[model samples]
Target: MNYQLNINWPDFIKNYWQKRPLLIKQGFTNFIDPISANDLAGLAMEDEVDSRLVSFQNGSWNVTHGPFDSYDQLAKTGWSLLVQAVNHWHYPSTALIAPFRVLSDWRIDDLMVSYSVPAGGVGPHIDQYDVFIIQGLGRRHWRVGEKIALKQHCPHPDLLQVEPFAAIIDKQLEPGDILYIPPGFPHEGYSIETSLNYSVGFRSPTSRELFSSFADYLIANDLGNYHYSDPDIATRDNPAMILPTELTEIQHIMQQLLAQPHIFNHWFGTFISQSRHELDIAPPEPSYTVEQVIQLLCQGNTLYKLNGLRTLNVADQYFVNGEQLISPKLNITAINILCEKQEIHADMLGNALNDKDFMQLVTKLINDGYWYFND
Candidate 1:
């Protein structure tokens, strides 16, 4: 189920990607919903799924976390149900994200779907990441304000909303329209009737987050082991005061850790390749033998990477689900092919299948639940 997304990539990237908001009519022509409202509600009931219910009544906003037992408490209107990372659990919905692969795969977050009844909304707010909100089953009226600084306040402990903003673009969205909103732009949407909106969110890691992850990496690898030692002893009247030279030396030591490209790249590759949400991974019940896997491929069975599993490469080094693939003793090109594509066939493996080391690695990946065969 490959969806057709009509857009001029070069033009959109140049003019509107992060610069402003753009409403693309018929972005997904004759769009058919991959999941229904009832199915979405079913997902919310699962203990592992991250979901929330937001409702506004009597001029107050309320929010509750889910694994909810019932929706009987929900108000007739002015309420919405949101479930995160639908693509990881629903196979049909994964196709909706395939068309957006024109952008970097590592930057993608997940597919969040929300269902709203008449007059339902989450209120005006700003996000720190870019998102593409596609209208699904019914109509929704949306208002998008320009990217600007605005004061935000939390109505509910879990929800933060912005003050009123002047809309730059306001319109009614039908089944196939898309609303692209960049970071820091204020926007709000409400249902004209019962509707579903699929939001494809992208990640933008902040400096604080990067530094924190790097610090953890440093600790894990026992890096930054250098101890400061000044051979020269200086006598100053104020010995308690920390000298500027000592401060500079401390900063220099920290910078040295970041200057090592090998260390930094390994940490980043492993870090970014990790999925933020849980993946639907099921190892084969009986396990697979190398010979059996080879026979299946020869019989024209295709190998499909698990949905929401991140497989990426940094030069010849490849990573999947936070662990680096052992490649020094294996065929590098074959590893690249596996990392580069979502699916592969026997011919795609070429001579790699003949190499025992490569086959051993592939067998481990399959057994570990990172990759599987399509039945």
Candidate 2:
């Protein structure tokens, strides 16, 4: 996955990312598809895969759980199958997500593949995350509009669609063409033929959502339990009214939670490394003893890399799989390579393995199916 970085990455991100939409023709010259339509359908059939089929008929929306055996039963039009978290399950699709890694991994989400029949689309809807919609096979007509009054919109139970907007850019995208739509943009696509679209979405959590998730994490982890307290406070004269002192105490608790650098980093890192849902991991059929696992690593017969996992290293800590590995002795250079780069050479694991605890940690990861070895 070699990218020329043709567009100035930083400037484009600062100026247009999440602000507007753009189409880059020939985004990847001579690009080969990582997964075929059949392969995608096969994945959808898996019980653990997050898949859905959405269709519209008689001016009403209908959606069903997928693992669809065939598409023949449908109206043949006005329907789409969406499969989320393709990257976690398919190694081939990783290339589709490579370009977006230039931005922070936390900002980038997963690759969602949608297969649409002729004239199929979800509708004119806005997304909360930035997305790159890549046309794979056939062609699709895309129309995008600046965010405007959504009141004119008529809602369907399954889809959040608006009345058609004056398209700022209306174009038919062929294979290899890309449509990049930022958050808040209203866009719709219609397939001229049976089409496959890969939506590479970036993460954009709202403040409210983040706060809620963080609060949940705090409670789950049994951290930051200080309650609002005002020993010298007086009750409000108005029976129904809350006291200003209580508000101040609540604000103080929030400030205190945010002020602790260690706690904040730990929580944030765990939240980031944690998978949105349990990934489909095929653990070793016959588990090995800890000594056997260590021997495999020592023998250089097996290679281990994190599975469906991304890690962040801030300060002296490295975070992965919702846990922090605080290692001042571990080489920052080595750790960075492990986090960002998918493949790591056998020699790189040498120093880390010298420590028995570290080797055990690696073994546990492999045993838990968070890491896999190449034998």
Candidate 1 similarity to native, TM-score: 0.95
Candidate 2 backbone clash number: 0
Q: Taking the candidates one at a time, how many backbone clashes does each contain?
A: 0, 0
Quote the positional error of residue 110 for candidate 2 in Å: 0.5
| 325: Cα error in model 1, Å | 0.9
lDDT of 2: 0.76
Each prediction's RMSD to truth: 1.6, 2.8
**TM-scores of all models?**
0.95, 0.88
Cα lDDT tens digits for candidate 1, 143-259: 999888999999989999999999998999999899999998999999999999999999899999889999999899898789998887567899798888888888999888888
**Cα lDDT computed for each candidate against the true fold:** 0.90, 0.76
In model 2, which range of ten residues has the least summed lDDT?
1-10
